[model samples]
Target: MTTYLPPEVQAGLDDARKRALKKSQRLSVQAGEETFRVLEAWDDGFALELAVADHLRGMVDLYDGPTLLSQCLIVASEEDGDQMRFEYKRMTEATGEQPVDFEKPENAPVALIGKG
Candidate 1:
């Protein structure tokens, strides 16, 4: 079956992809027992939610420019009219680890376009 995402969600994802390409940097996030790169991010109004694969080990890290922020998980397209939300508890747990591998092309999430 085809997965259908809300229009807002799609727009958020698209914005994230553009941002990632423009920065030319990969993001690392921890899921369960591994670290993975967030192929793309979806705007959820609060924070930018990332679409991640594998690398699910400890906690997720979000790097913007020279600053690196940690969070448990990134949620996208939240109804709160925000970009994303970070779970502080999870982020504090994982520290000092190798960067996760972000599988490009195949693992990338779909971007969305905001209306009005």
Candidate 2:
């Protein structure tokens, strides 16, 4: 089954996804024992939302392939016009005061390819 999405945001999301898929930008986020996907990323932290039956606070690790990117606290948030997502609590040595723009073609994480 397919869900219908209106224009504007959907169009932009589709375009960004297409570009990201081509570059193989796969960001792996690890929290506790479960790992989630990064929908949006910044210098300090990344954003992710999963079917979490409950919310808890803990350290989250973001990785690009085998390399560790950021390790920080994650909290749950459900705001208006936003998905029930989790965000990094603070910035670490990986990310400085200035936020680095991700989701861009040049700065997006690279996806890993495997053989069948």
Candidate 3:
């Protein structure tokens, strides 16, 4: 059997799917002082709402809610409808500060057991 949905029903379903995706992601991009909701994210790059001008290039930070995921230098890749794709020029994971003490013999030159 085959079933077909009305045009309006299809549109409503599509809108609901988009909203669910955005809510499930819980991700945002911080560019300068402005933040934008991320439509989707992958290992090498991510997509943002098509709000900025074309050919955007700069450093942006990706965040999972309040926690920062990484700092990335991005170049606009393409635009699909209301979403814009960006490819990462460079990506650096956010690192935490570590205190070093030269006075301690165990930490004389810093530990490197599993830092490879």
* Best prediction by lDDT: 3
Q: TM-score for all predictions?
A: 0.26, 0.47, 0.71
lDDT tens digits by residue: candidate 1, 2-116: 8999999999997886576545545545445554444444442123333433112234556544356555554332322322333243333335766679645876668977898
Task: Assess the local accuracy of residue 77 in candidate 2 as a C-alpha lDDT between 0 and 100.
Answer: 56
Q: Cα RMSD (Å) per model? A: 20.7, 15.6, 7.1
Report the error of model 1 at residue 87, Å: 12
Worst 10 residues of 2 by lDDT: 45-54
Candidate 1 C-alpha error for residue 39, in Å: 1.7
Which regions of candidate 1 deviate over 4 angstroms?
1-23, 45-59, 63-67, 74-116
Question: Which regions of candidate 3 are displaced past 4 Å?
Answer: 1-5, 51-56, 98-106, 109-116
Candidate 2: Cα lDDT at 28 = 70
Q: Of models 2 and 3, which has the larger lDDT?
A: 3
**lDDT by residue for model 2 over 1-116, one digit each (tens)?**
87877898798996786456435557777777886656566554444443441354577777777777777787765432332455667745465456657545776667867898
Report lDDT per candidate.
0.47, 0.61, 0.81
lDDT of 3: 0.81
